[model samples]
Target: NYNVLEQVYDVTKFLEDHPGGDEVLLSATGKDATDDFEDVGHSSTARAMMDEFYVGDIDTATIPANVKYTPPKQPHYNQDKTPEFIIKLLQFLVPLIILAVAVGVRFYTKSPSA
Candidate 1:
């Protein structure tokens, strides 16, 4: 009754053959084991052995009530907007440039000392 990447696998019979031990496989019964399987870093031969135990694809409609399916997030971007680096540069430089121009104007307009 274990699900791995949407595939149903009956590991109950293969429990004794599991290299990690029967307890490890038994612990993952009736649950998604994709993460656990990948984390264990099973060898290529071990991966090939999975086909022997695979029963069929999990029926999406029949999934248990507790299982929550999350849809992938959509990527968001403003294609028409200016690039972030350019916008940041303008934000930083525009004020400094205006301040410099104002100071220059003040210095040029000052009367000469006697």
Candidate 2:
């Protein structure tokens, strides 16, 4: 299980070296950052200080009804990374051949246990 206390202490020490901002780490406290808890050894409940300690002061956004973000211009340069069919076939074949060799070696090396 994740220990919130331990995490807080560790986070405090690491905060000084944090590049982006200390607020980012502070905000991650009560939130769930673990994607796979089943395999993880530690976890913690992140505090909802995102509103309280985040980088900038909280202010209401004022976007006009007709205002829209200007889209970036798409890159016109093209290297044409298309590959031939035979090249793709060889790439697929090489991995399968290696795997088959590995499995064959394991099977040959296996001996029944008493």
TM-score leader: 1
lDDT of 1 by residue, 1-114 (tens): 654347889988888888899999988888788899999999999999899998988765565579677998988866547598688888999999999999999999999999
lDDT of model 1 at position 58: 71
Model 1: lDDT equals: 0.86
Segments in model 1 whose C-alpha atoms lie over 4 Å from true places: 1-5, 64-114
Which structure among the candidates has the greatest lDDT?
A: 1
Candidate 2 error regions (>4 Å) = 1-83
Task: Look at candidate 1 and give me any clashing residue pairs.
Answer: none
TM value for model 2: 0.27
